[model samples]
Target: MKWTEVQEIAIQLSERHPETDPAKVNFVDLMKWTMALPEFDDDPKHCGERVLEAIQQAWIDEVA
Candidate 1:
């Protein structure tokens, strides 16, 4: 996905999780964390999507 799309997704996630501070949420760090997850061990693409979803979910959980 494009950086613009990633940024928009990040913004939406930030809005969902006020405590996450999207400004401070480094995409690279998030990718690293997501890749480290056991569930993503088999697929890099899935890991990436999971990371994005996790970021969004974490943000939502934080704000909710």
Candidate 2:
């Protein structure tokens, strides 16, 4: 998933880390984990704070 696929990425993250709280995740770890997803394939340079924030919010929504 690309950085632009915020919801998809959040779904994957929620499934992969069910025990974790998306609201508590910092951007650094968030980016690292996103990059670690098997379906993820994109340039790290393409990601930014806004992308991470969207992903985190989506993940929180997914969990909620």
Provide the TM-score for each candidate, comma-separated.
Answer: 0.35, 0.98
Best by lDDT: 2
lDDT of each: 0.50, 0.97
lDDT of 1 by residue, 1-64 (tens): 3322444444444544455554466667666644444333444455455556556555555555
The local lDDT score (0 to 100) that residue 30 gets in candidate 2 is 100
Instruction: Give lDDT for model 1.
Output: 0.50
RMSD of 1: 8.3
Query: How many clashes would you count in candidate 1?
Result: 1
For model 2, residues 1-64, the per-residue Cα lDDT tens digits are 7999999999999999999999999999999999999999999999999999999999999999
Q: Can you tell me which runs of candidate 1 are displaced by over 4 Å?
A: 1-23, 42-54, 61-63
Off by over 4 Å in 2: none
Single out the weakest 10-residue window by summed lDDT for candidate 1: 1-10
